[model samples]
Target: MASPAPTSAHTGRHLPHPVLVISVVVAYLVALHPGTLPRDAMTTTVVTTGVTALGAVIGMLLARWVSRRHGQPDGQTRRVVLGIGVLVAAGGAGLAVWWQNLIRAAVGAVPVGPDWWAGATLAPVAVVAATVVVPRVTAVIAAAAVALTAGLLTPASAGADEGQPLPRTVSESGTLLRGELSAPEFERPATRLVKTWRGADGLSARAVIVAVPTGSGWVDPAAVTGFVDRFGADVRILALPYADVPSWQAFISDDAAATESSIALVREVAEVLQGRPAGDRPLLVLYGQSLGAVGADAARTWLEDRHPGLLAETVLTAPPAETVAAESDSPRVVVANRTDPVIRWSLSSLWRPATTPDGTVLGGPRVPQVPWLPVISFLQTSVDLLAALDGPTGVGHRYGVEQAHWVTGLPR
Candidate 1:
């Protein structure tokens, strides 16, 4: 056999594989601390960097293996390498999806970027494009990854921040007071509003409006303000303070305790009102969201069972219909999201009763009371109403005296 043509200048002089560089960069990004980016940015960066790097590594290995036979002067080797490159890219993309899902379960599912699978699928194509145009594709992708991850630190271009939480309260004039609830009322941040805007004209004259927030944990007090501005009519929203609980997780998980505690708060507030000058005739509208919604329903049921003529109306947004009794003739409107998995999970507990018709009236075991309507939307309509522009303004839980969707349709 003719001496095998001395392995040409190409012998062992293989160009550094692009895949190796890409993989290293990806590992670096994934391994980096997540807190460096804002909540949304963190998800996007981690997913992209992880997927791209993995794809590159896989592509390089495949290319090396396929080069043996296709390395002919005629050029079959280039074709083989190209085919292998595609396969490697696909594999890398698949891995990215898997990794992202794992991360999601670990942290609560906040909005990351596009779904992991979709991102991974596109990784190979991006790599190919980078390879053709850029001398160091790996470095370029890495740089892009860093930029994307870091960019979240910059406020969004929309001039509004969806990721950053809203302030707990705002004035009708539009001032944002951003911060967590105080130590005492952490469970129910809405309580702070009572102290913050007590002097806003007509507050003392208006009927005492009780806002029973869901859970012992805190939600943005601003949401409460939005609700008050939208629906409160000549009424003051008195937010309950957070009760001392071991932890947020415990408060949310311990439904019975939450309900009992909330009921006590409502009763205490009611008693205080009862001692006032016009307390007996005061129009008490019990309102709440999610868990607080249930609390409002239960409190109404208690009043119907005990006081009879105490409350005027109860409006619950995303209320757990099952936990609530049907003794309300006070117009009740419920907002639900078709896409919120949370509603389904929470409302189905054995402690809660089956849902009755919206207009059903209840008394003892004989009759049911009140009207029930399910307002459906993709987004949590009630939450959106509060968080979105048509909501409240200013800061420190001050519910503007304006009207919005949730309040506009009420039977004023």
Candidate 2:
């Protein structure tokens, strides 16, 4: 009889590793405790489960490829594989933690408890266990488990609130205008506000200012009021409230939706301006903060394409990494606080050196520089960001009284 095929442990499929499965489930449950992750429980569960399953499938594919190339590993080879697997899993865990903190900052959510840490710790442990127990299958299950755990633990955006109805026409004074416009991304009417400041010179040259609201629905009235106070009546301010989706979390998650809506709004605004006689047309200025900044930045290319030379300037304050590209031709200004974690934690700025804009102002109180380790930076900045949120106008994030001063510098 043919020599019994060399009995190989790796030759046949094996049952899932129990240790890996249990660790994964327990870790996820712990991280997703209601206090740890505040959101719609059912939605969280479904999304987390789906992500985990996808990760597992990807891991399995990677393991199979490795097995096909290397065949059954010797003791030493198995040890090497396990070591690499652990390192990769650990890196993944760290990344997940960083991302969680980033999202919390974006959505203005409170970060509570060390449940995420506990979940992160178990991720690598599960991966190593899975690799050792089922060498051929490797750590795919572990990866999947970790993904699910982390995802479930993250906070969800706040649901939209029933807002006051949009107004039909300009305010009685004619300096203020509030109304609604139709945009594809929004199921409800998009809120629009316009405040015109025709200076003592008698609106000879009108300055049209378009401001995007922050994550908190309408643009801060104080900020807008301040702008009008400084600019006088020559300026016309157009504002949009991004309240359809309501939360910053939703804004960040569906950036495309925000971008599309903004572009449409800008297009409509441009059409209205185009209808005016050339001599009467107002000089345009675009402004946004945080998520609003993101929307404004995303619309830059389209804005320039459709209405070249129309914009006097674009101001983005505390902008995220995604909006870091240089707008060399236009007067694009970036106002950032040196100590703000949101500005500092962005990996995009690191990867691609953000193009220094025409004007870059460092606002807020300085935060002492700390050692630049990934884990340390994430933890420190997360706390700092949360504290900044507590201030009356978001201390670090807000431009304070300096907004009008900066607006004065923009071209005519």
Candidate 3:
């Protein structure tokens, strides 16, 4: 005969085990993380479900460990464990919530998180799943860790150019030259080419402009033309339009092998140009925006260090202070919007807020003046990077098409 009283059994069905309860609590609490962009209801639900599912797995593992170590915990022991876990979790969550809410107020956003109804529905499913893995209650509580990733990123962020339109002149007459420079890579178009013309000095010379494709694995040929057209007939453009595909991994990775390759390409170009007679050698110019700008600056630094006087131009748009130190004195031209997060965000931002020194680069009108809180400021800036180029051409991180004036107007 089977017993009818399943409730009286030692299973923690009605009353969740300490590990299960704490996992659910911490899971939902972490789901409140203030992300960069505002997510819709469906996104929140999907994210919450994933987080809950992950938390449940960890909770089950901890419960299993405890069961093996000390057998099934009694109801009193479970209650005590739950009390301590809940208190600690609640205290930390309280501080995080306060900071997140502060960020919401600063960024002109409302509080965001999973809804109560959704939590009520999915949380139990997660708990039940955990309980299935370990039928008896245990004292060990599980900690859930979640990693947020972007499904889509802008070309500026990812160093990807979906469609780069070339100027009509590129197909028309004189069409500059091709194959004057190249990178040692398996890319479709390693570098753009250009023909030489009479410079203001009454001498026929070429200027090779290397476009650092912003942490991008691939290159945009149109970027070469953007500056090439400005040269009229005096420069040869050697911008890279490599065939490598760009991804967020390439964008965030510290090593950024693509960027390093660009530096190597620049070095190769300089070595070849240096081999030419002093007066006949083509002038080298480095131009890039955002991550490209960082690469451009590094290329110039290398050239200046080894082949002094090899570089003729340096245009770095919206470079982060980390790349180009805030204290350095260099002739490099930097065009940066006042609120461009790419230029401002850093690890130090967690403690120090961004301040405008005298002569802020290409300083535009100031945006919202919000109070900065430690961790909240860092989180806010992190998300701001995603939407940095969503604004007008002159605002945020977009510097527009007239970037060649600074270089073109210089004496060559």
Candidate 4:
């Protein structure tokens, strides 16, 4: 039987196992490839190095097994395998790099330099560069990575199953969910509620949505269309203030002004239906996402306290660290994704794992197997929050129709 060699050499008595060397190198490049979101340099480095080393160890074991059963190829077979591997590796590495750039382009990411095309040549060179590290070195590195992973998951796994409190937030997303909608005020100063949809007859609706925008504070036109298109008919009302505050900031800063504006918007909605009896009034739903979602919950609580049974539905997406307390049997949705670091992050998440979404509104874990480790999960998830909006639609903070879809499905 023949022993394995490094990717850089076919010299000495043992030749490199083409499969083993190729597998590890391929894995490193693939891991570097962007996911639903882009990663920063530090995260890219951590991810690539960990995956590369782990793949190397697995490749070594598999190669050894193949050698024991079938023996290593020699002469022409050996040379051919090595040649083919080099070609394949070069192609695969280049492809993965190019694919990531395409994603960057889609998101309008600023290039490292204006001479971006110059980086194209580096892909093929990576095939050679990737495998220069000795297998033993990679094996050691893999051990360290495993230890790190375990340490972080320890905190995440604690109290993961024990839960009594109701929900909260996805995939990694580097792209921002951008929207272009005008925010013109109504008759009231600083307060506005635009009618996004009306029945075909142009006179009726079953309910009205006091919808707030995502953290960016700009309502998405598609979302307005969604409520009407999905449900066949409903008057879609978007809540806004004349001078909008960026919604994402609500996470770090206590924007009492914005929260109060949201409260005022709900009150205006109630006034519009003042003369009608409670049973005859169109169902009022307070809806929001991220910080907006948090505000919606708070506003609902305030409204319910003053006028019971006014808010029949409340939908929140990607709410931050805490949930508001309410005293009502109103139906609501706390859309959450297992992979969403935003929902997974909090002081409580240091020991308690994220709760799963209850019903169909984008429920279930996007990355269910990743266990939560105490401080580690918190830190890792915190990093994930950087590019949270970059994920695809309905992922991370880029929710679309699903937010309303879940509400429409519920018994109204």
Better of 3 and 4 by TM-score: 3
**Of models 2 and 3, which has the larger lDDT?**
3
Predicted structure with the largest TM-score when compared to the true one: 3
- For 1-412, candidate 3 gives per-residue lDDT tens digits of 9877644344443454677667766665555454433333444444455555666667778877877887776666566766776676566456544554554444455664656334434544554465455534411333222222333423235445555422212121232322211234413233222222222221244566666665443333434555656666666544443323343344465534445655666766765677778788666777776666666777767777788876776777776646553432335666666657777676887888755332235654444444666765675566566666565555556565555555633563
Predicted structure 1: lDDT: 0.42
Per-residue lDDT over 1-412 for candidate 1, one digit per residue giving the tens place of the 0 to 100 score: 7777644344433333434444534433332212111123334434454554555556566545655645422234334444565565455445444443444433334434564334434553465346534637666766786687565433111112233333444323222222233433333443334334344532353445566544433333554455445444444555443332322233355555445545654565555456655543345666665566666677777766766656666665544435555445555554443222223333233333235426332211111111222322211122222212221122101122221134322344
Q: Per-residue CA lDDT of candidate 2, range 115-175, in tens?
A: 5465345443444445445745654654665586666444212222244233333232333
What are the Cα lDDT values of the candidates?
0.42, 0.50, 0.54, 0.52
lDDT score, candidate 3, position 263:
68
Clashing pairs in 2: 197-233, 197-234, 197-235, 198-233, 198-234, 199-233, 199-234
Which of 1 and 4 is ahead in lDDT?
4
**Model 2, total clashes:** 7
Range of the 10 consecutive residues with the lowest summed lDDT in candidate 1: 361-370
Q: What is the lDDT of residue 334 in candidate 2?
A: 78
Model 4, span 1-412: residue lDDT tens: 8867544333332545756766676665555444433444445445555556556657777878988999875555556676776676567556645655554555445433322322333322342244344645644655776687655422111111122111111010111111122333223422222221221211246766766554345454445566666556555454553223344444445545445656767776666566577666667777776566666877777787776767777877666654444233567777654345566566777787655334314443243233456555565565566667555664445656656666743453
